[model samples]
Target: MTRVVFAPDSFKGTIAAADAARVLAEAWASVDPGVSPVLRPMADGGEGTVAAFAAAVPGARRMPITVDGPAGHPVDTAWLLLPASDDAPDGTAVIDMASTSGIELLDELRPWDADSRGFGQAIAAALDHGVSRLVLGIGSSASTDGGTGMLRALGARFLDARGAETAPGARGLGDIASADLSALRPAPEVRVLTDVTNPLTGARGAAAVFGPQKGLTDPSDQQQTDAALERLARLLALDPAVPGSGAAGGVGAALIAWGGTLLPGAAEVAHLIGLADAIAAADAVVTGEGAYDGQSGDGKVPSFVASLAAASGVDAVLVAGLIAPDADLAPFTASASLTEVAGSPASALADTHRWLHEAGRRLALAMRGSGPASGS
Candidate 1:
């Protein structure tokens, strides 16, 4: 009997990762009745991180804390505590960057004119919860202050060249010429989980890769943003050229400076879920996310899972909502295949189940070597 493991990230607006896994599991059961299927939902420490963790680890506790959304409003967010120290009783807490400062929350609160004050508060709350190690999922953030607000929430201060406190948003990023970490008060054990490796400065840095998303327009101002990031780094007494420094608006940089270790978000979570063991034991491993493209290769959940499966001598397949040109991930996995659902992008969004089933049938047939000539 074939042992298949289905691990998929959320399909974004379409389906949850668990639901996607169910769809794949049902497909495999229908095609190969004897196959044993394992379902594992994955996340990049972004939007569904809390749900994914809650599903994987029982006794996970959740507490609501107000944090700065992308635009700087007090959005009600959550901090999840898992099995940790004896004093806390609850496990280590999972601090979702998204919960406090995600794009969705930003949109709801109009983040363009806001700051990240609440994000800082959320982190402080986690520390107060007696969390042994704070797992800061630094993705899907709404702020472009390079985590200035996040640092502020932890007691770090951003000062301008004139030595005045800067406002807690990107607009004031240009004036930031220094940082003061002497007053910072973060937990002793903190790990930042991020997918991006871009630095906090330069052309490939935060302002370049993510500024536009936060409504930055002037190319000249990008340099200022980079400078602001560097200033923060200097305040923390560290180098800003570190990889992942640009993640979540430079939270990675702030975390590193503040004694937080940086880790690959998806890979770390996968380890927490015993993904490698599952891959080693499976006859075939299937992984995917909301979308697949060149970016997926950069330590994204699907690509990371593919890499693990390949190392374990397991064949893998990628099934995604949208398949871009470089989304053909077979090149990276030793014996991998890529398949997309049928229907236009809009149709797929409108009727997710139909195409998810279609995609599943197509994948199942491919696995059995009886699939059609083309997915088109």
Candidate 2:
């Protein structure tokens, strides 16, 4: 029996990574009943990070909670609790911003008003449960408040010149005259996961590189926002030039202030889920994400997984919802894009699973050096 590993990140607005892996596995099995398929869903500390942990960890449990979302509305979400071990005496709490306070939680961009408070609230909840360590996935963040909203929820106080609490989100950044970290909760061992390495306040920094995506496009606007973050960094006594400090619109810097360590998101997730060993033993591996482009080569899910496969001399197959026209497909032995298979981008996204199923079938056949069977 040929062993094949199926690993796919969430399809962005459509299927989850776990669901994508399942769908691809089923499609492969339909084509080759003798094929052995292993499902190992992947994430890059983004939206599907928690779900990926739930699938990979043996005894991970979901702890539900309600917290204020990015749009200042209540959101029901869950954090993952991994059973205690010698390495982690009091167990581990896994929380992701995507479910807690991510940009996706808002109907529209709240560049100035969206906050990371919900993410901090969830962390506080996990801390209340007495977890000794934390694994925070701070991707898809909604605000550029320099993480003041999150720090506030964790017991830090951000006050204006008059000694009054400032407004929430980036809107209040300019008003923060002082921050009181005296009341902040005691630090627990924290590992902040993110693939971004942008600095905190310069040209390649958070406000300049990512602020535009969240609606702070003008150079003057980004400059002002960057200045605010710079001010916060000075107050907190953390370096603003450190790589990855600008991730999630300055949440990374805030976590650093809270005594957490920054680590590569995809690499960490891959290690936690044991991707290397699995790939070494498999004949071939398949990995994918929503979009594959030039940037995908730089620390993204597909490239990381493909690199592992290559190290083991295993054939790696790449599949994606959409493959940019100029994207280098050299990492994989073969590749498929839902957009090409489904005719149009709209058609692919409208019924993503259908196209994914088709892509899986096509890839499975291609692996066998065979053409499609009949109309399949």
Candidate 3:
């Protein structure tokens, strides 16, 4: 029997990683009944991180809570509660910033107003549950507030020149004069999952590199936010040049201030999900995400899986929602693009499951050496 490991990340706005794995497994099985598929949905501390853990870990529960969202409204969201294990006697809380403070939560980009308060509120809720450890996924952020809003929610005070608290979001950062962590809630052991390595301020830092995406397109705005974050780092006695300090619009720095350790999201998730072991025993490994582009090579799921497969001497295949024209697919044995199979990006996204099924079949056939040439 051919053993195939199905490890895929969420396809953004389309399919969740767990559902994508199931669909891929079904599709592969349909093409080759003898094939043994191991499903391991993946995430890089992004939008689907919580869902990935919930899908993979038995006895994981979703604890729903309402918090202020990025758009200044209450949003009902949930965090993952993993059952007690040898590593954590009281259990672990998996919180994702994307659920509360992500760009997706905004109707239209609120560059200056979007804040990480909602994310912090979620963390506070998890802490209240008495989780022994925290697994925080800080990705897809909507604000550049230097995590001041999050700190505010956690009882840290961000004061202006007159010793008054500032407003929320990035706009408030410029007014901050001091920070007080005296009243902050005591943080438990925190493991931050993030792929970002930029610092809190600089040319390659948070505001400069990520502000545009969060709607801080103006050069002046980016510079202002960057300066604010620099001030925040100084006020908190944090190293602004630390790797991952810029993650989630300076949420990384905030977590560090609260005694959290930063970890590579993809590798951490892989270890947690046992992807290495699964790949070792598999005949082939398949991985993908919403888009396979030049940037996907940077510690993303597909590249991470490819490395694992290579180490295990197994072939790695990729199935992407859309493969960029300049994407380098040289690491994969074969690759398939949903857009190519479905004929259009719109059609592929509209029916991701169906097209993904087709992609799976194509991959199965390719593995058996009976399909057409595969390359995107």
Candidate 4:
């Protein structure tokens, strides 16, 4: 029997990683019932990070709580509570920024007003539960608030020139004259998971590179936000030049200020979910994401999985909702794209699971024909 491992990330805004893996497994099984499919859903510290953990870890509990949303409204969200183990006697808490202060929570872009306070509040809840370790996934943020809102929720103070507290979101970043950590809660050991490598305050930094997507379209606004982040970095004694400092609209810097460590999201998640072990034992490995583009080569799930497969001398296959026209698929032994299978982007997205099912069938047939599947 052929052993196959399916490890895929979520198709952002459409399918969860776990769901995608399950559907793909079903499709593969339909083609070759004798094939043994091993499902291993993946994430990159974004919206589905906690869910990925929940699917991979046994006895992981969801701790629901209400907190301030990105738009300053109360929103119900939950964090994951992983039972204590020998490595961590007090247990572990897994939190995702996208669940609390993410862009998906907003009806419309709040730009300067959206904040990460909700994300911080979730962290506080975990701290209150007496967790010894924190695994924070900072992705899909709604604001470029320099993480002020998050720090504030953890009992830190961001004051203006007059010693008064500033406003919320990026709107307050420009006014922050000082920061006080005296009242901040003692933070547990934090491991920040993210794929971004942008710095905090330049053309390639958070504001200049990501601000426009968060509704900071005007060049002046981007510059101002960048300057504000620079000021915040100075006030907090942080090095803005560090890689990953700009993740989640500067929330990366904020977490670091709180004594957190940063690591690649894909690699970290892969390790946590035991992807390496699964891949090593599999006859073939399959991986994918929402879109395969130039950016996907940079620390994304597909590329990471492909590299792992290559290291293990195993054939790797890729399945994507949409493959960019110029994306290089050399890493994969075989590749299937929903866009090509469905004949149009809208059609593919309209019913993603159906298209994914077809993609899986095509991949299975292709692999069975060749000694090892070859990229199409």
All-Cα superposition RMSD per candidate: 3.3, 1.8, 1.4, 1.8
Between prediction 1 and prediction 2, which has the larger TM-score?
2
Model 2 over residues 125-145: C-alpha lDDT tens digits?
Answer: 999999989999999898898
| Prediction 4 global C-alpha lDDT | 0.91
Native-structure RMSD, model 3: 1.4
- Per-candidate count of clashing residue pairs (backbone under 3 Å): 11, 0, 0, 0
lDDT of 4 by residue, 223-267 (tens): 999999999999889999989999999999988888999999999
Clashing pairs in 3: none
Residue 95, candidate 1: C-alpha displacement in angstroms:
1.8
For candidate 1, report its TM-score: 0.87
Name the candidate, 1 or 2, with the larger lDDT value.
2
Off by over 4 Å in 3: 373-375
Which is the better candidate, 2 or 4, if ranked by TM-score? 2
Worst 10 residues of 1 by lDDT: 331-340
